[model samples]
Target chain A: MTDINFKKIIRIGLIVYFAAIALFTVGTLSRLKDGSVFGLPKFLVYGAVVLVLTVCVLLYVLHLQKRLKSGKDAFGLRVLRTIHKYRFLIEQLVTRDFKIKYKRSVLGVFWSFLNPLLMMIVQYVVFSYLLNFRGTVEHYALYLLCGIVIWNGFNDCSTQSMRSIIGNAHLITKVYVPKYIYPVTKVLSASINVLLSMVPLLLVTVIYGLIATPKLYLSFAVLLLPLALLLLLVFCIGIGFILSSLMVFFHDIEFLWTVFSTIWMYATPIIYSLEMFESRAPWLITVMQFNPMYHYINFVRSIVLYRTAPTFLEMGITALISFGTFAVGLLIFKKCQDKFVLYL
Target chain B: MNEERKLMISVQDVTMTFRREEDRSGSLKETVTKLLSRKLKFSTFTALHDVSFDVYNGDVLGIIGRNGAGKSTILKIISGIMKPTKGNIIRNGNIVPMLELGSGFDFDLSGRENIFLNGAILGYEKPYLFSKYEEIVDFSELRDFIDVPLRNYSSGMIMRLAFSIAAVVEPEILIVDEILAVGDENFQKKSRARMMELMGGGTTVLFVSHDMNQIREMCNRVIWLDGGTIRMQGETKEVCDAYRI
Candidate 1:
């Protein structure tokens, strides 16, 4: 913060925006009174340039801002610098979380992949055969697996991250590193588990003859899954910041979240399909649409299971939900973070 | 170049208050009920009150106080672990705190892994820690048990390990809070020598202890904090003798 260089994009945006203003000013002063001009007045020409530049610059700044968007000190170049400086600490934290999780378990990291696979197995039996349900949804295993993959990723990331800051009270009380990095570590650690679980996700798809079709295997939709995953990662980190900071003040948040998440899981169209609700209980479809998790899973399911790219409307909703929660999360964390040591 | 006498840490009118529920029930349900019934109450405990001090580069300062005299609170503030409720602290250069040795070490991790993990927690970059790896282990003198998990290591062993890791890096500022009281005499001598070496290298140290003798021996200046306020501060012997009586 004391001496930081704003990254190239922001610097460039500022420069361009100012350049436009300069052009506008110059145009305003130099009237070019000899009005044998091409269609419009000289001032009008400058105004046009200013308007165009303003639009372009505004869009560019907004895009650059999506990464660390909140504060003069909170976001932008300096925060990135601290993260870069403390990258190793974050790496070690993530490593510790991963190691501790599987430390004494008989099935260490195999459980990462196997847990979802087993859950899918049990879900397949329960949902497909026992209930004799699942109307018109093809590739039920792949469908269920995709939803589990994304939902579990969200579940683990948010759950662990919400508690991550409080869990590391010992370290925080004794050291000075960025507080947000702890939640980031949890996000990355759980994301690693989620990312690793994708192996089985792809395996199940290939095994079930889902991806054997050339168009399904080679479509551009295949590439968008990782982008979808990154969106989920950012979204969860934002929620993590909000929840972890809130939990410090309200110790009940952690327990309340447990109940809320259970309700949220049922609310999401995970085990059941949205089409069923559309056909039977259409009112629940409104709530399903509002659930961020539903939109994200629908986007991914569209790409992976159905082999069709998500529509612009779906993509926009997903991004809006993700970025909306992320911005809210950053605001909450920044506001509450300074008082953390007091509460802790 | 020639920064030896520059002011390193300046604390200006820092005050801290922690709130406690005076007649609160433990359960959220009971707390809510009492709150609705106009019975819930809280009291404020001030740990520090407008306390201010400055330490110059290459200064070895000691903080001596009786129990609950805010000695550790000052250390925590200087270390940047706790923010003051009021006032500001302007600090220069990298700071390393040795407050309560082994407080951050994960007992389940091996000593070697904990070294890296601890170094990371202290904001030491991975490459830098790896470069100082051998020296840290050697200085700890627990080389044989370096591969063993810390839970298996005795308390003294953990202290040595914590001290070695914290002191190995010659930071611009160091804060210690009574961690040397636990280890054996030989280790204590070793740690004191290392701390002196750090001072010789121009690291400003803010140390806290109840031992007046040690304060008089090592510190160039001493601040005696009592009841969350600075009772007296001057040269080492002046304040130590005043507090001892």
Candidate 2:
């Protein structure tokens, strides 16, 4: 009669993962502040803790995955049915969210195009002209454009997904679908928004004459944008799962996230460059390097703006960060989902 | 009544405890204080306690209770919408639960779109809904305005659309809430006829309602729930008279 609560166990895995990330960040930062190599005893202590935490989470994920494969639970089976066999429902939900977003609006989905273009102009005027950032940064328009779009993908998805679980309470309790699908649907809708905005990104590239400088075959770097987008989308969904689930328990996260995003936007090399902080605050540059958005934005900018492939090392690290967040996010969402009926 | 029907659903000792935030302080500051002192306060309302029941194949089991009697909670648990705090539920076949009439119906979406949306929400595949689209519309009698947004329709019209889809789906097991208490007399009659048709096709039904007369007519057996416990259960007429006394 009693079965394993995959939801509860997975959520605990998420919390452990969160602790691991925080501890790993602190450990890395401590090593940097001590001006010692990562081999310092302090780094090892932190590293061991983080390693154990990650292993625990990984083990749990594997365990649940095995159970899922064996088709053991009624609730789990029903949820799987909703996600895979009833895949049409998820598609319909995405379409419904997309359509509702543009309903009754005058400019409609074209705003996706005009929004980044207008923001690029305004940002170019302020940062390029007022601050004279162009003197320090090459092709400042394209740089700022890439940052805005990349940051927007994270920003919009996080914000929307924070509300996705609680906002759809009416439907979640009424239907027996997988509760996690709501956050996935939000991520998909946000991905579509980002997809449309990519048009202006290309237009900016054309205006700047970056495409012609390279051979046609060399332009293949541009194709790397999809891989980068896929990476970021999964990352957002991961973070979305975490934020949306936690927001149900604590009402203040939504408010806190707005402030966090503003700080995060500045923390990443979005409007400014690593050059600006080089001599004055090398530590800030080091911290920015640790930011996931820095890796993602810089990776795409390498392809689209700089006409170079992202280094393999950089690609692997970014993948780890995104996939790590997604795994943790999913764990937390499943954990918090069953109790959602009580909270909502 | 044939006594040899197979078991359609087996519910055993399902217990649901609802944690009610009673006299709780909302401020984060107070929450921190409570955390330090360990005086956080709440009360648990047991909605269903040790509830056990079963549904035979093709039987209409009517559930009756006062409002806070865990009647609706039982329906939700059996439908897998909300997992019970404690129990075992064995479902034999595919189930379609119309737990809340007009649930998952978006107000801004057209009636036709809602049919697909609601049908999908009820676990119907797209192709099946497409096959039943015209029949559902015809049954709901909304041909004149299926394209219009559902928000424009009156509550009765929405119920008509909802009932039509639920009826057309032909689920093996149907868990219905108090959906029949809506619309006019004509629609209620139509809904009853549809229920009879489902019963004829060997579809087991578990329904929750307060109408004594209707329960007597539609149900062969009835169970009375009170304060999250099964107070009485027997043949419909016998249980109804005992409940009245």
Candidate 3:
């Protein structure tokens, strides 16, 4: 029974991936060299905006990383040992998340696709009519779709990862697992959801006559997007490990996080294209250049919009920053994890 | 001390304390004051203090304690679920703790799925558990409902299933924490027999319970804990008698 379900879920994941690829191809081809794609030639002002956003994100990551490192085993191999020690518990929570989240829901996981699709339509209507925005309908729709889907992955991962450790306070206090695995699972679940949301992106692209292209298959670089998101997720998890552990003793983080997520949403280039400020904003673009999330979004845009591989420079920078932040985050989270039981 | 009886578990000079908060008022000023004072103003209640004991392989060491006596805390420490505030515990075997059967089981999952899950929680690998699947189902007598989700199971059914899984998987050291009280008479008989089989083998069993009769019947040696201290440690009947008063 378990094997059957596992296979079924994997099949669903594959189908979603395939569908996303086809959709991205069609969408990119249709919008290629068309005057409709917000027509910003290397949006300089937008770079400035993303640069500022990047600096803030980097500062936040560094601040939290410092706080976590101030405790024991600053490198945090001890926490990794703890995770290996309680691998079973992590597996249990993963299965629990699967069962509890999907119980009695008819759409089951199809809601993953349905959710982003519905959001796309609603946003299209609101932006097209309420704001009186005038971009090509297809461009606006596809841009919003791509951004929203990618943001959904990020939002779901970070938001869930923030609560991942705390939400399982019962397990955290009672059972010992690597404190990072819970947050990792939260990120993975959101990643899966993001992957599923690609289905709608595909269906919409097909409607616009953007079918298969050599660039479409090359979209496999999108898989690398998770690696970057994972770094962010790790950064969040590490921060979560310290914050949530502290939150157990002092209970204000939940409320603080709700507001932080809102600010974080605007901080990322999800709602608007990074091209919007390219020519006008210099300092902002410089700051945005440092924003890892900007790179994360651009990573997606490179695959879906630009129809080419992400430049080695972008990939190299993202890889270095992401893995570094991820390692630091893990170290911090592990250093502070043992303090949780004492605080509780 | 019998030198020939090698110690499988040693609880030496263990002390556990918990802080009792005095106020429930919600005030930033109060919190700030507490922070400024750099003192939590907590009155420490010792849950276990200077407690020492040892058990050998194949010994069923029952712990008899009154309601506030820290029996379960001892189990928790031994199980590695909770850390001791001080002292050290050296356990020399694979400890399969039935701290709370079904504690981690997701109610939405089917009985079969939960068995594998709960088995893993108790430290059994998936393939090993799958091999013993038929035996577990047969022992629990829940074959017909194996595929049904656990939330639908009655308390007896839950206990039966949980007990069966724990008992079926033979561990080097088994700590049973007051699970017998919930089982029906038939299950009680089955569990008792299973416990006897485990004790008769090389598995060291640390049984914690309030039932004196069960302790007297099952344990060769007993320790009675009172208010975080062991008041008596000796033969099971002697300790039980001391605990009764």
Query: For candidate 3, what is the TM-score?
Result: 0.76
Which digits, one per residue and each the tens of the lDDT, describe model 2 over residues A1-344?
12345667578858865764664363235232342245565555656766896788687577667767787555544554445555777777788778778877899999899888888899999998898998898778888999998888789888988899888888877777778788888889888999999998887787667454332222556756777898999999999999888877777888888999999888888889999878998888667767999999998888777766566467789999999999999888888777887777
Candidate 1 lDDT score at position A202: 80
**Which wins on TM-score, candidate 1 or candidate 3?**
1
Task: For model 2, name the residue pairs that clash.
Answer: none
DockQ of candidate 2 is: 0.46
Residue pairs that clash (backbone atoms under 3 angstroms), model 1: none
Share of the reference A-B contacts seen in candidate 1 = 0.68
Candidate 2 regions exceeding 4 Å error are: A1-82, A210-218, B1-4, B24-30, B179-181, B184-188, B199-201
Minimal lDDT window, size 10, model 3 chain A: A1-10
Q: What's the CA RMSD of model 1 in angstroms? A: 8.7
* Residue range A14-78, candidate 1, lDDT tens digits: 78657645642532242333342478875566567668978886775575466455444444455
Q: lDDT per residue, candidate 3, A230-255, as tens digits?
A: 55555444444555455555566667
How much of the true contact map at the interface does candidate 2 reproduce, as a fraction? Answer: 0.55
After superposition, the stretches of candidate 1 with alpha carbons farther than 4 Å from their true spots are A1-75, A210-218, B1-4, B23-27, B179-185
Q: How high is each candidate's TM-score?
A: 0.85, 0.83, 0.76
Best by TM-score: 1
Give the number of the best model, judged by DockQ: 1
Ranking by lDDT: 2, 1, 3
The lDDT values for all models are 0.80, 0.81, 0.69
